[model samples]
Target: MSITDKNLGSKAIQWQAHQNSNSEVPENTMAAMNYAWNLGGIPEIDIRQTADGIIIGIHDATPKRTLSVPEADQDKLISELTFDQIQQWDAGVKFGEQFRNEKVPSLKQILAGLSEHSDRQLYLDFKQVDLEALAALIQEYGVARQIIFAHNNHENCKTVKRLVPEVRTMLWIPARFPETAVETFTHIRQTGFDSLNMVQLHLPDAEEKQSWRYKLQKTFIQEALQYLGEAGMELEVLPYKFDQEDLFELLDMGIRRYAVDEPSVFVELLNRYFN
Candidate 1:
């Protein structure tokens, strides 16, 4: 499909801000996400639960990378601390002086801000946490329809489905799926997830990079998509960094949605290509 208005789907394929679209800053923050969204990108929060069980937008097993912390605490998981402790973290100073006052936001807080914008869409990368609390917030804000829940576990995805029946959910397709194309489709169907998110198969490794092995792998992806398309399933792929050629290959395979960290770059390419 072309990256046309039609192919891009109901809304433009906005860039999912990876970690608030800023690396040094703790992601899932209002500042970082808003910064990107204001610049015409979509916010994708990687959320996790704290030791005290509060839901917040966070990625990584520890707080070091995003939060300013001593090297000793670098490996400490967010689960080791309470929500209050997490909020006290230097969530933004490392990123820049402008964001120094920014603090980690609770899920409810983020939802509250988003409630104001009718066009705002959030793609949440769930870290297999319980969705009951999150579901309640979405309901309270009346934005259940604006969220897309993405998770790697079948049960977790099922939980999202059960808690927020109206929300769309994507199940992660493991690196090693069933042996054959038919088997892959069967596996996905069995999970009963509404959609899927998978790793992009086009990357380095010269021998298999663009040769016979690479072509064969791409063939399998195409076959799987064919079955999924016929069965009314949708696949979204995200590569850490996808070059122009990578975009064309994925497009040739009928792939549409892309969850890229640098969404503006890709979106610009898509616009240029489609126009």
Candidate 2:
């Protein structure tokens, strides 16, 4: 099916909030997701495994960027810290004082809390964890169909399918695919992921034509959409920044699944520009 057919389903486009409405405050925090949900946006969170193999909602591999940590402890990877130790560090202070009380939420906490919103679609991005363990957690919560699991490893995806075939899955493509279209498609097909996601990092103000990287990514993704669509895979893109005309261009290109940080902004933009 085409990206349009797979994602849009008669809507203009489906927008997922990056790291759960991260454009507002402390990213990957429950508050961000709550705001996103209140605004009619799909919540997205990246899960990282702690030292003891517990899953937590954290975007980066470490707490250096998102959490308040001693400079000496800045280099500690998520795998090096226990979930209790990891949660002790304040995840909200760096953003502002109002959210200073926020702590990192465990995958279990998020799943247990949000499972009631059966219609709310959640994206769970795996950083470095066993898919089987993650699958087990989802199964325990009885939310296998409500969550979309994402990872870059094709082997991991295959394992996820083997372990929990009912859970939805998405593949993450990096900035540089570094292979022929056919070769990439082969890997994607072998993985049997239901959807694909890629990040578009561009300065908000720069002209789309001024950046060679943007041009390259644009060309690559355009072809990728065609290949995946023909092979019955859907595509989703996380645009770091966008404007009304720019977004309109993307929609015209048949991109129906967008990963935008500010869902309310896009909602308003779409309502004002198209209406």
Candidate 3:
């Protein structure tokens, strides 16, 4: 299959709901995944391992931010606690009382939930977890092709690819490293990371008008795109916020895939282009 097929299903333009569509539901929770799935969009979730080696979806190092944890246990790390201990905290109360019963979902739970929809794909953000174990679990669930493993760590991308050759992997360029974005792509080409299925480019924060936030020069973007196309790798953009001008510019440049936090806003603007 082509890189696009490996990474996502057949769609003229596709988006992975960043943090599982956090704008409408709690980020990285099953509720968020279900919401995105209902909308026929892919859910991008962050994964980390518990003390007992069970992989779970969560963004931060601690549950203090997303869960309703007390001040006394604010510093507790997910890695330091067993899955059972972490499940005691309410994952949705902080987001809203209506979603109060949402528990921090384990990777198995996420996979099982996904099994129901064979057409849907998942974007798994590798935060801190065993590559082999994670790959094995995905294989066990028989949904390797339906997953796109994403990570900022190049080594982790390579490792996961080595473990599961069929599973798609995305290497996201850090927005903080705008100056070296092209250099990073050049390094990927030179080093022969052929196992890589896709590269995620971060567009500068539209609301934040800082010079450093200016992601990459246009020339650099073109060069990177040329190289990626030649290498048979797909490019997915992560614009921190939705902007009409920026989205159109990217569309003009031939970028069709995106990782968006608010799918509704992105889709509304996208519809304008087609309709």
**lDDT per residue (tens digit) for residues 155-214 in model 2:** 666677677777666766544323443355556656543333332222223244553323
Ranking by TM-score: 3, 2, 1
- What are the lDDT figures for the candidates, one per model? 0.65, 0.70, 0.81
Predicted candidate 1, C-alpha RMSD: 4.1
**Candidate 3 residue lDDT tens string, 99-138:** 9989999999989877777888899998889888999999
Q: Against the true structure, candidate 3 has what lDDT?
A: 0.81
Total clashing pairs for each candidate = 0, 0, 0
Error of 3 at 96 (Å): 1.9
Which stretches of model 1 miss by more than 4 angstroms? 1-15, 20-26, 71-73, 96-98, 174-185, 190-208, 211-216
> Among these predicted structures, which one has the highest lDDT?
3
Residue 100 lDDT in candidate 1: 80
Off by over 4 Å in 2: 1-9, 176-213, 217-223
Task: Identify the runs in model 3 with alpha carbons over 4 angstroms from their true place.
Answer: 1-11, 206-213
